[model samples]
Target: MAGEITETGELYSPYVGLVYMFNLIVGTGALTMPKAFATAGWLVSLVLLVFLGFMSFVTTTFVMEAMAAANAQLRWKRMETHKEEDDDDDDSSTASDSDILTPDSYERAEKQPILSVQRRTSPNLFEITDRVEMGQMASMFFNKVGVNLFYFCIIIYLYGDLAIYASAVPFSLMQVTCSTTDNDSCGVETDAKYNDTDLCWGPLRRVDAYHIYLAIFTLLLGPFTFFDVQKTKYLQILTSLMRWIAFAIMIVLALVRIGKGHGEGHPPLADPSGLRNLLGVCVYSFMCQHSLPSLVTPVSSKRYLTRLVFLDYVLILAFYGLLSFTAIFCFRGDSLMDMYTLNFARCDVVGLAAVRLFLGLFPVFTISTNFPIIAVTLRNNWKTLFHREGGTYPWVVDRVVFPTITLVPPVLVAFCTHDLESLVGITGAYAGTGIQFVIPAFLVYHCRKDTQVTFGYGTVNKHRSPFHHTFWVGFVLLWAFSCFFFVTANIVLSETKL
Candidate 1:
């Protein structure tokens, strides 16, 4: 299976791929969801979350199918090149013989090559053997304007992501470290609000502490963007383990608080006005579509790919429900922090000092691991956007300029405001809409047409989406438009109220 796939990474079982997808989808967005749930009311949040999860799953399948199509298109072009070379050579037979299809590790190993001159159609050609990133797919399927729009949307989305990370880590650190109460008495709830003007260390203010931590964070993680750095397998495993433990601890503590008679929350049944932010939260929470190629391409078997995706979504939805439901029942909506982990620290929910400390610092640990990775990704995208054909970048420009541009803007944004809820909402509602909804719809639609033109309508893509009809593509686009309108109206009304 490793030999069959063309990616540089090692192949893994589908189950392992599922785990990667799960970790990718559940991140800072999930941490903020409880607050969004609390504000929107439990019923509204649950309904929107389930529907958005389904919508996200539909687009995920679109991306996977488009990946298979991209692979087929690459194979088809290579086959054409091989045919052209064969025609020019007197020993064309030798050339053709050397290019014969060998048995792959997939279930279709026994099948003949779809690109053969004798047979220009085979399902094997469409098998997702190559790891094609979403940007590359945009270049393949979209025209000049479309490609530029795609890059613009994704760049904006990544900027918002970096900003969220930039603020979240420091905010968590500031809250955890600046608390004046002793460990024994920290569990008692107080009406005191720790605003920016409040003193943390003698004359130092809480806002000043946040800035100091943010600076420290940048100094530590910012350098990685200048060089190529990837999250190694072991690092991924360690961070994922920590994430699970953190989430589990929060859930259990919330349940314990609710199980006792001390539950302080009595949320409304529904709140239509909060639906806008809730939509963004849910969309952001289910954001694995952008990273699906990296996760899905190396799977050893994809015969049941759609089924596996469905199962993953179901589990994610259930887990999210459990987490948010416990939280809303255990604490007041007004008291829930943007970072849910912080709620446990200030309340009587957890009497243990170590547990509270761990919950408070959890975001700092988990987010720090991802910040460098996202920063590098955004830097590379900037280079790609401005790249010219056969042109080379100078060492200083390539190394220094790009990373600086990527890092500075987000840090400046974080400096102005650490309002993570608004940041996540706006990011997910706008740019995330393009990445999660618009691009996949167009990619699958255009890729389907291209596949039919090259391989004929008879060639079937084994990994094609369950919602393969032309109407599904239009449906996704319509939903994207509706989301835009709905979110825009919500923002306007919110401002009017203010």
Candidate 2:
């Protein structure tokens, strides 16, 4: 099956298909995962993260298979049409020559056989060529452009939400650590040696704003960047490596902060189970449902996808657990927005400087990562709207115009509110819920087949069992209702004084 050629003798690469799986998971979610755990609490958040990963894996595999089946059907239709056209052309050529038969006709036909052959072949060849070209264009538009657009929208929503929350890190840090005693009101006076540059004023605030704006701008530009996916292979590899490095650093930071007993901050005033709330927040911040889609989408070997997904989730869970425990132990009364919460609150000038530098440069990584997703969405929709091959139009409208139009509203919202909690909450309650929970459930239900059920392989489709179908239907409805409730809850929370 791997080496089999189509009737047209074209070869396909299995490797390229696998790469997409890694790309999807590692892109936007890595940056904000810590924050997710920080919001939800360890036990609940960790469980949810694991469940989310499983669901994502199942859903992605189902979708990939469904799409592959659809493409096969389309290819079959194209091939059938081509064969019919070829037969019709042969008949037409034969009929046209039948009228002039005479005693010398045999001699004339023999001498002009090459001419007749050319005549018979030319029109069919032209028709086949046209069909092939059309097929290629259609395939490119659907696979490259259409799918990419959906990805773009999902990432924009993810990154935009993350930026809002990440931008608050510096401000939140300052609130927790700054001393009011000296002329430097926003500065922290610590005995720890190192040069302290005050981030309270001057260029730092502008820097923060710059990071926030850059993040928003990147999210806006994401839909237009899909075309470059084929071109930016090396850049993507480098970025992925950088992201993994960042994740490593975050884990180390979480461990160090926790080891020093600086994890938990002030206890929650409203919840008597303050430790649990703190734990929940830390877990929520780290639990990233977004990464699951990537983990499950590409299978390098049979069963390898599932294995890797399990492994990644286990690693992620362990990281979250360690980070949360250390955080609560170390900062018992002062934990804030993320697991490395104290990096923002440390009394050492050098620590603060390092924190500021990290905070400043972090958004750049995020923006770069998110750009492709946005670009994919814009390119796909543009093709759909115009009924042409993607990137066929060479005007600003195809590139600049559409991205700008999609991005403006979100940018305005970012600027106007600039509230991290509100933004993150809204995203989690709406977009996060849909992408992580709702979509996966639907895909699983739609793709499972009856023959696969006896071996417990068909949970995704479950077509053989009406019970499974009803269960999935209810599950999807429940997810939808939850999404609506959370969205409404977020809105109310944002508006009211509760």
- lDDT, candidate 1, 91-154, per-residue tens: 4355445444322311132232234422546669888988999999999989999999988988
Query: For this target, which candidate reaches the highest TM-score against the unseen true structure?
Result: 1
RMSD (Cα, Å) for all candidates, in order, is 4.9, 12.4
Candidate lDDT (C-alpha), each: 0.85, 0.42
Alpha-carbon runs more than 4 Å astray in model 2: 1-40, 82-231, 260-312, 319-335, 338-360, 372-376, 379-400, 437-470
Model 1 — which ten-residue stretch has the worst lDDT?
Answer: 102-111
- Screening candidate 1 with a backbone cut-off below 3 angstroms (N, C-alpha, C), the clashing residue pairs are none
How many backbone collisions does model 2 have? 51
Tens digits of per-residue lDDT for model 2, 23-53:
4444333333434444444455556556545
**Whole-structure CA lDDT of model 2:** 0.42
